[model samples]
Target: MKRYLFLLVVGLLFFNFGNSQAYYFPERNSNWATKVEASNSFNQIALEEAVRFAKDNEYSGSRDLRIAILKGFEREPFHKILGPTKKRGGPAGMILKNGYLVTSWGDTKRVDMTFSVTKSFLSTMAGLAEDQGLIKDIDDRVGDYIWDGTFDGEHNSKITWEHLLQQNSAWSGELWGGKDWADRPPREGGVHDWKFERPKEPGTVMEYNDVRVNVLAYSLTHVWRKPMPIVLKEHIMDKIGASTTWRWHGYNHAWTEIDGIKMKSVTGGGHSGAGLFISAEDMARFGMLFLNDGKWKEDQLISKEWIQKAIKPSKPNVNYGYMWWLNKKGNRHWEGLSENIYYAAGFGGNFIVIDQENDLVVVTRWLEPNKIAEFMGLVNDAID
Candidate 1:
């Protein structure tokens, strides 16, 4: 009886292992397969509830994104839209389970501006650089690559690739007509106070400053010796079978010469303007790549090691990891969800959530920011 029971247990283990290896990946320009009627893995009513919640709780910001950009960041001094802004569409998103489309709302093909979610893409560029040996190590000083005065000062010189990736660089500088002190100054402080304040040690405090992020972008442009968008397309997007509609934009004045050719340095976020403009479906594809440990079909577009490092929490911010937001127990934690969940989030409710534990990828656009946790929780509750 004991031998028979052990044989049954081994058989079950092999079956589960074989099933886990059967994740589907969509091809370029191909329709993503749906499991709505075919699969009984999800609670259909609960899944519908998640979709309804996302659609009903659309972002309150103006659809005319130019007006939204200016008004949303009105507190910043001299804030101007220096890059292209497009009017966004209604609430649009998709939920994928085991790489199959489970449910989606709005026009999934409509290309919309994804604000700071661009940071995660920028972070991926750094990972690619490291994977290709362009960046020897994340701990290496940024000043070593670009000797331009950007990282000259004592405080800025101490900044490393990891520090910038973690948003704890605290590098003080102005770029593309945006001042470091003026980007998003504290509510209680004036320009004089912010400008004169000493910067914290690199890798110490996490501050969400766009100027610093742009600096990282500028430095990476030098490291890769090409426009970031081109690198992204050739290295990641193309490999993942992303659509042609996606674009990565930089500020009008962020152009610089590299290898005797001028290339625009893209912003990590859409603070003043311009970042990644992509369709919900493309974003889902990118999330799917990350969900599969940076692999798409037979290709490992990005190293598994890089993806692991990208999602691991930094010491300075447990909820942040190389521009990706963690669902860890912090201020941004989504209650009742898996702690292993991580996502790319942008302003005005753009999100690409990767729930690896459940083999789920959720892309949400124009959702009310505060309602994300609840919406995600509802989606989580749908799994059988």
Candidate 2:
């Protein structure tokens, strides 16, 4: 009996030890820890090659982002820089392995515009609202909460939180002087035809429209009853030990009254201009929070369930999730990379790739947008 009891206790001890995590978390306002010898986990030559590849293939756009925005989107009708834009720095990025800095290049601390990577952050806001029960169900009609004319129409009323997050709400209309149909209009159609066309049923198709994205931001603002920036700062950024330099912005005319006080609604991308302006390091930290399944050290800032839902493939687009881009086999899938990989991508080549299986978080800025797949392939090659 004594011998049998000893074996049982020993087995239990081994099981508990095996389940314990062995990752690191950087403290607030301090330098992140780095791998003492990166060679131990990564092939030094391959890793160096990845960094060099990123630096060599810088985005070929005007560093003055205002010019870049206007010129880049010139194909779209009535596209204009409607919000604030900043001159961007050269290529900068960081790679974290098991929460330790593995390698970095360029000015990791330089704050720059992150463009549509803001969408992932905005999606987190919805996750927070759901976690707090502010949104009882994502499937619940958004009109049920806002009640404002923003969601009054038959088509618009069908938009649920999930549909908005998935970019498939097909919520037609205009906001902040931008018409929904004018954004990335059909390549073949004229303005009149595009405007008069019927919008697809919510959840049936995915359309990447800035006006629809802003509608989501506006609705979320009403749901949170305060500035979305404040909610992000208080709930996620501060808790994750992000820097004070990061800022979220909306269009110049994007103000609305909330609780008797006027507040500016934030945008999900920098397509027309302002979204998230942040440093590469801060972005990596945010990536790390998701890398560990929404847990930061001892605190679970966002629930694991929400994180799971955020990364799952949506029906309309296998390559998209709740604002996060999945690497599932699809149009945007990176060849030779794990299908489980997910990332947040923005214009001007900003990306935050989360490879949970390998315990990696890679944040790159100003890389050539098309070069990401090749760069990630090289990065993945480094992990021996």
TM-scores of all models? 0.95, 0.94
Runs with alpha carbons beyond 4 Å of true place in candidate 2: 1-20, 37-39
Worst 10 residues of 1 by lDDT: 13-22
The whole-model lDDT of each prediction reads 0.90, 0.92
User: Candidate 2, which ten residues in sequence have the lowest lDDT sum?
Assistant: 13-22
Tens-digit lDDT string for candidate 2 (224-310)? 999999999999999999999999999998999988999999999998998999999999999999988899988999999999999
Q: Which candidate is the best by lDDT?
A: 2
Per-residue lDDT over 12-94 for candidate 1, one digit per residue giving the tens place of the 0 to 100 score: 85564336445678999999897543246689899899999999999998999999889999998888999988999999999
Cα deviation in Å at residue 242, candidate 1?
Answer: 0.8
- Any runs in candidate 1 off by more than 4 Å, and if so which? 1-18, 36-38
